[model samples]
Target: MTSTAATTEATEKWSGQLRANGRRVTKQRLAVLTAVEHLPHAVADDVAAAVRGDLPDISLQSVYVVLADLTEIGLLRKIEPPHSPARYETRVDDNHHHAICTSCGRIEDVDCAVGHAPCLTPENTHGMTIEIADVLYRGTCADCAAQAS
Candidate 1:
């Protein structure tokens, strides 16, 4: 497909997603979502930078608001690693986990290790039905390990 045709198709897809979530499509929203799609596991600052290419006036605060809204509406997944700013990703439809590098803070997706949603079964539920699980594994990444060695 032509570049213009592909752009139009992607825009329509993003618009459909926003409308499905009862959100009004705007340039900022479109830019932010597109940026996140291209940059998985991006922080708000990274999103803002990516967005500014298309929307030079967009603010970091606006990116944060958009990120929070997208996450609340299930359009995005927000993951927080210890001592690191929260990151956003478009992979929200499944029960996947993350692996964070202790040395460089790089994040990568880790599929559910064993079973389905709420992959890890806690010994106690406290009477609440579990729907999903958020897991974060921390270790030095290959690059970091190689550098150390």
Candidate 2:
């Protein structure tokens, strides 16, 4: 498909998502969602930068608000690794996990390690039903390992 057609399709998708989530379809929201969709695992600052390309007057604080709102509505997923700013992604439909590089701090998605939702079972749940799990795997990525070597 053409780039213009692709852009229109994506805009429609984002608009539909916002409306379905009971949100007003505003330009800032659309821009923030577009930014996150283009830059998965992006922090707020990165998202702000990307949004500014299409919205030069948008503020970082506004971006933060949009990000939080999107996350709260389940349109985006926020992941916080230790000592790193929280990152946002559009993949909120599944129970997935992440792997972070210890050296460079690069983050990558890791599928559930085992069976269905909440892949890892705790030894005891204290009678509470578990719905999902957020697992963070830390290791040296290949580039970091290669650089070290």
In the range 1-149, model 1's lDDT, one tens digit per residue, is 99899888989998999999999999988898899999999989999999999999888899999999988999889998899888999998889999999899899999998858989889999999998888999999999999999
Q: What lDDT is reached at residue 70 by model 1?
A: 89
Backbone clash pairs for candidate 2 read none
Q: Write the per-residue lDDT of candidate 2 for residues 30-70, one digit (tens) a residue.
A: 99989999999999999999999999999999999999999
Question: After superposing candidate 1, which stretches have Cα over 4 Å from the reference?
Answer: none
* Candidate that scores best on TM-score: 2
TM-score of each: 0.94, 0.95
* Candidate 1 residue pairs in backbone clash: none
- Cα-lDDT of candidate 2: 0.94
Q: CA lDDT, every prediction?
A: 0.92, 0.94
What shift in Å separates residue 32 of candidate 2 from its native position after superposition?
A: 0.5
